[model samples]
Target: MACLKLDARALNGLWNADHWERELSDPRRICVGIAEGSDNLSAVACGWIVLDELQITVVAVDPEHRRQGLGRTVLKQLLLDASSAGARQAFLDVAEDNHGALALYGALGFHTIGRRSGYYRNGKDALIQSLELQTDIKLN
Candidate 1:
């Protein structure tokens, strides 16, 4: 997994290229997972540390790479890194219908905190979830 060196071009290689340049250029913290021995990215997670909270703006895995634990690994790493950076909590929004993501987050100790109606461009509700990071707990 790549962290500090992640850029828009690398992110675009895994998913849509549209407007990624601007998103990646933002000052917020970001993390990315790349397939070993290749330039292809398997997962990407972006967020920022605000006070004691790490507000995640995006977490995505290539469709082809889904169900392989790549997303979980990426998120786990991000949480650990953020916690080490002085973030005590982590938050993210997941589409209500995204069962895979919901399951992943749930397994990682995140619980629903609230919901946003019509939060997505597709008009789907978003489930807001948060996790208290135990920085001392190591992820398996």
Candidate 2:
């Protein structure tokens, strides 16, 4: 749920991270399926963006809300939003152990562009992937 997102506590800090917000602040930035009205307060994806470069900082659905397709919906929205913005591409770093996440990005047209060794606090590595955007299609 939104409450369980790593950025949950930093919700307020969003205003301070306004450089990204300045460009991502469109009320219609993206369509968040099941973004609200979940049984719990969150049951949604927690994300951020810089132009078309979207970041899936955290996405936690309430146990009660699992398997309902909310997670994928949120991811789709983030990708669409970034593509609609100006991002020539979008990138995310997923822990090597997170097979599900890797699959999601792969299914969404993201490709592993690089890797960061010991990128996690627990010494886990990370896969950095990106989705290239068509500049001609980017909106102002």
Candidate 3:
């Protein structure tokens, strides 16, 4: 899929096309995507709604499209949609060394709630961050 191509350029073995395909088929999953053309995906944010929570699974942006607010745009859309769908909170696990992602999440009001040691295949620690979402929350 288009996300797989962007994933190869932006992500590091986080999730594969097969895994994404399976997850995308689930009814509780929500995704927001931005594409330059029919075949060029610029950025994407995906999450799963569970009870009153939104579990942000992945956010990927093409390396060529970084630092242009694409990630923030898509993620904000995801959060808005999830809130509308009855999600009261949002959470995600970001690699400890992924400063860019940490900063983005921080700017979005997500704070570190926990950590997972050696969470990734590359042995990076994963910082669990969470945000309390309100139906009228303004994500800016």
Candidate 4:
């Protein structure tokens, strides 16, 4: 996996265009994890840090790479990096029907804080989750 500074082009490539402006205008609010392949990226995770909160904006793994633990690896590293960057808490919203993501976040110590009805374009509700970061906790 590759952790790199994401620019607008990279963010675009990773399927996160909705927040491109925010990510590009402020460098500190962006972190991207890439699993590089010989020809392209196999997985990607993007997040932002604002004040004491780390918001995970997007995470995607290629269809062929699903269920391989790549997403968990990326998210775990992103949380560790966020904590190191002074984030006291982490937040993310996952589609209510996305069992895989719910499981991953649950395993990482995130608990549902709230919900947003019809949050997704497809009319699916989003479950907001949060994790209190402890410096003493081991990420791996």
Can you write out model 4's per-residue Cα lDDT over 1-140, one digit (the tens) per residue? 22222322233354344455565457776555554654356666668888988998877666666798887877787888888899989888998998988988888888899999999777999999999988433455
TM-scores, each model vs. reference = 0.78, 0.63, 0.94, 0.78
lDDT of 3 by residue, 1-140 (tens): 88888778888656788988976788999989999888899999999999999999999999899999999999999999999999999999999999999999988888998999999888999999999998334576
Off by over 4 Å in 1: 1-19, 22-28, 36-38, 135-138
Give the winner by TM-score.
3
Best by lDDT: 3
- Over the stretch 1-140, how does candidate 1's per-residue lDDT look in tens digits? 23222333333433344445645666557565656556566677778888888998778776667788888888888888888888988999988998988888888888999999999777999999988897433376
Off by over 4 Å in 2: 1-33, 36-43, 46-52, 135-140
Candidate 3 vs candidate 4: the lDDT winner is: 3
lDDT of each: 0.74, 0.57, 0.90, 0.72
Across residues 1-140, which tens digit of lDDT does each residue of candidate 2 receive? 33433134423323234533442455433424354545334333435566546665544444456566666666666656656665566667888888867766676677888899999778999998877656322222
Clashes (N, CA, C under 3 Å) per candidate: 0, 5, 0, 0
Error of 4 at 5 (Å): 17
Q: What's the C-alpha lDDT at position 58 in model 2?
A: 47
